[model samples]
Target: MRSAIWVGAILATLAIASMFLLDPSLWFAPERNTLIVQTFVAAVVAAQLTLVTAMPLAMIISSLRNRTKTPLPTYIVTVCECGAVFKSKPMFCSRCGRRLQEPQTKQAV
Candidate 1:
């Protein structure tokens, strides 16, 4: 679906570019009112196509962004038998060499 929209946009750009390149006098020709009107209609159609394609593209991008998950923060603290406070949990107390208690896990609010 996205590829189709891109192809349509590229084709519209090429058509508009070719229109101007093929007839530089179309803009200044007073006798070619019908050609000028056709050009304006084509431009309006191209703009509408762009707007229609952009809406779904924007929605897809926003949905993709919303689907991503952010990592949660963790907090750990341990107190040893010797009254030593440590910010991180360890296998044993640094001063007493005793096995440390299980670390408590806290969830962020």
Candidate 2:
């Protein structure tokens, strides 16, 4: 997404720069110069519109991707003899610092 913006900006810069570099006669010919400037302005406007539109489109796509993902399993609860309960079956009790026994868990639905 960031790369797309950079590419668009670079291309627009190149287009504007090339308009001056490619034609030295544009300075004398006011009508043709106006036309060229207008064309480049239109191109820049179109590119900006595309980027603005794409931001929301990309966000929607990423949100849909996240929505479709599977959820992780819930943690099992572990109880220490020191009367401390911990989730996810820790190696030692937090309060008493004693080693925990095997966690007794129900089946995940």
Clashing pairs for model 2 are: none
Per-residue lDDT of candidate 1, residues 1-109 (tens digit): 5655556566656765687789897667775667655655665566667778788999999999988966655755577767777777788878888887664434443
In order, the Cα lDDT scores of the candidates are 0.69, 0.71
TM-score between candidate 2 and the true structure: 0.47
Over 4 Å off, model 1: 1-31, 69-109
Off by over 4 Å in 2: 1-11, 32-37, 76-85, 88-109
Model 2 clash count equals: 0
Q: Write the per-residue lDDT of candidate 2 for residues 34-63, one digit (tens) a residue.
A: 776676677666777788898899999999
Candidate whose lDDT is highest: 2
**lDDT, model 2, position 44:** 62
Clashes of 1: 0
TM-score of each: 0.41, 0.47
